[model samples]
Target: MFTRPASDEYIRYQNQYISIVPEGNIIELLERQQDDTVNYFSSLNEQQALYRYAAGKWSLKEVLGHIADTEAIMSYRLLRIARGDRTALPGFEQDDYIEPASFDTLSNEELLERYTSIRRSSLSLLRTLPITAPARRGIVNNHEMSVNALAYVIAGHELHHMNIIRERYNA
Candidate 1:
């Protein structure tokens, strides 16, 4: 089983999300989370998918899109770090991404398809990494990060959003 990342592997602010993940093999957790996420979103009806808990909040569709986008970005970072790239990567503002993507334009089914496909691609890439990959380190958003921490962030970020959906969106 893969071990949990050390505290120093990631920045302190990310701990809120990372701490949400239970102890286990992170790859296994990610795989299970993909299925769980897909299932949860699939259960929502059109109206439910569009529901936002309050004004100025993202709809369910936006949340799913955000999750997929985050996975893609995190996985990209993982790939680069695993490949021994020491270059510093820039960080993206989530709100900037959300505003232009027009996530709400697509049906829930389409959003799910996009989400599942991206997650599957991430899983495939992760499965092929060298054993030493997780120990690799790089800079992102000006913060030093490890490949293992990126994996945990990907999973934990999803869990964080899922909790928000359950509690706020009531989906």
Candidate 2:
């Protein structure tokens, strides 16, 4: 149960890509997010989950699949950086990842299942990381980022997409 420290403006500004969940139970917060995401999808029908804001944008199913893929990628980066690997990690373009029209065939239940499974794997990986690993730094997407920073970025990314799904797609 790693507890996140209180947010300082300087640190927040430095790690602009991350989210700041309250201190004293960051793992719980992550797990809470996992549960909330499950509930969020549970309430939606396939039509709702598959709704798209525009012709070019991703539908809700594609969005969920994208989240799962991104989580896997971020977790892999976290694992490598935490293990002291100094390799420069690559970044992904979400738009490119979500394209190709393959995800349109997936159902809401399948998307949710994928999201849940990927999250479980990520959580397991995070739980086993040594404390010192969080401080290790690495280059990702041509920017310097710490292992801990990547964790927060993972959480924030999901929140960011979910917000869009709610407000824009009405899902």
The candidate scoring highest on TM-score is 1
- For residues 1-171, write the lDDT of model 2, one tens digit per residue: 243423431134434446434454556667998998899888888777767799878777888888888888988888888888888888777778777746778887778888898898888888888877777777777666777776776787787777888799865
Model 1 pairs whose backbones collide = none
Residue-by-residue lDDT tens digits, candidate 1, 17-95: 8899999888889999988998998898888888889999999999999999988999999889989999999998999
Deviation from native of the Cα of residue 52 in model 2, angstroms: 1.3
- In candidate 2, residue 92 scores what lDDT? 71
Clashing pairs in 2: none
Q: Give the residue spans of candidate 2 off by over 4 A.
A: 1-24
Measured over all alpha carbons after superposition, the RMSD of each candidate to the real structure, in angstroms, is 1.1, 3.2
Which residues of candidate 1, in runs, are more than 4 Å off? none
For model 2, what is the C-alpha lDDT against the true structure? 0.74
Candidate of highest lDDT: 1
